[model samples]
Target: MAPLEYLRPSDEGAAIALAEADGRACLLAGGTDVVGLLKDGVLAPSRLVDINALPIAGVEIRDGGLSIGALTRLSDVADHPAVRGRFPALAHAVLAAASPQLRNMATVGGSLLQRTRCGYFRDPVTPCNKRAPGTGCSAIDGEHRLHAILGGSDRCIAVHPSDPAVALLALDAVVRTRGSRKERAIPVDDLYLLPGSTPERETLLEHGELIVAVELPATSFAARSCYLKVRERASFEFALVSAAVALDVRGGVIRTARVALGGVAPRPWRARAAEAVLRGSRMTEATIAAAASAAVRDARPREQNAFKVELVRRVLTRVLATAGAGG
Candidate 1:
């Protein structure tokens, strides 16, 4: 690792100013992913703006919703009483991520802002368009068994590797951020940008913007939701296919539904078509399969990853069934 200037900003305004001044400055939160980038030589920022001193590390209820600080550790958020009680899907998603040690050090914002787990992007020697624009995407022809099936373009096929964001998408969470220009809020689903022509740009955040917090609406779905992650190993592994399902079933009929998928898209994918299929319908094997099919109907899979379409359908079906059963 190269020696870099360390800065401790007293306020968000100062932090934003510093970040704007240095184009290569990287925000230092939990140092989980940033340190990995530093060690791997993928990113060598000229300055490190340590935001750990900022007052952004708590979980609270405000305006009838849950507001989680960006600096809150993943372990803390997962084990939070309100989260586990009201948003079990979010809790389960956070708990299912990485290993215990990594979760302990990973922050909520950092978890969502983590880079793609694609081997080509991580390898500095590889010609990855995400790492360097116009260099070309190697994963399109290389080992892409774990690549995306949806929201992929010719420029890039790398999938977003955030587990919690998938559940947040199902819960319709809102992301709040502060940039040098002003503060703004965006839907959790909208924060991620698809890799169309600009594979280098992964998020909608401006140059000096920093994630402040994420707000989850106080809805019934939060209580009756569950997350299902299918990975190669029992632990310490990214998902091959993950489903987050939230259903509001009443009198043997689903009144409302929220579904999102992970490990199969450039962003945390929300299956609104599947939700539409479930609304006002009774939970049945056939209905679940139909909704699952609708969820992956638009998926564009490559040769090695063609199985992901069916795998996501099965995962969605199983997760929806579990959510309906109040599991």
Candidate 2:
């Protein structure tokens, strides 16, 4: 790895100023993904701007909603008393992800900005359009069992690697970012970008934007939510198929529903079709199964990943059933 200048800014303004001046500057939060990529020559930045101090490390409840600072550690969020009682599903998902040590170092912002786990994208020598334009996606012809089955294009097939974000997205979380202008809020579902002509531009963030916090709105669905993840190992592994489901089931009918999927899409996927099918519908085995089927209706798998469609469907059904058990 090449030697780089490291900047530990005392504030977000200094961090943004450094990033704006240096085009090769990369923001460092947890260093879980960024450090490994730097060592492998995947990201050769000239400057490393650490934002761990930039007004980004707190959690509070304001106006009946929760505001989690961007730099808030994952372990803190997962273990907070408020989160444990109010958002038990999200807490469960966070504790299930990575390891105890990783959770201590990883931040909420870094997890949201996590890059794809696809081998081709990580290897700079490989033909990856995501790494470099017009290079072609090796995943199209190579081992793609863990690649995307939804919202993929000919140029890329990498799936988003986040378990907690999917659950937060399903709960209608809002992102607050500050850049050249004042801070603004964005819906979590809108933060991710579809793999189109520019696969490198992953999120809606501008070049020098600083994520301040993420605000989660109050929802009754949060109380009866659940996240189910399936992976090769029992722990310390990424999801092969995962589902986050929450519903407002009253009078034996689903008044409202929310569903988000991970490990099967290019982004933290919101199952709008499945949620639509569940709204005002009875919560039965057949009803849940049909909604689950609808969730993966647009899944297009490659040679090595056809089983993901069925796996995702079953997981979605399971998560919804688990959420609705005591409702």
Q: Please, what is the whole-model Cα lDDT of each candidate in the order they appear?
A: 0.92, 0.87
Write the residue-wise lDDT of candidate 2 on 74-133 in tens digits. 999998887777776678778877999999999887888889999988898999988888
lDDT of candidate 2 at residue 28, scale 0 to 100: 94
**For candidate 1, what's the RMSD?**
1.0
Q: lDDT, candidate 1, residue 74?
A: 97
lDDT of 1 at 198: 95
TM-score of each: 0.98, 0.98
Q: List, residue by residue over 1-327, the lDDT tens digit for candidate 1.
A: 778999999788898899899999999998988999899989889999999888988999987889999999999999899999989999999999998999889999998899998999999888999998888999999999999999999999999999999999999899999987789999997898899999899889988799999999988677999999999999889999999998888899999999999999988999989999999999999899999999999999999999999999999888888887885
What lDDT, from 0 to 1, does candidate 2 have?
Answer: 0.87
Any idea what lDDT model 1 has? 0.92
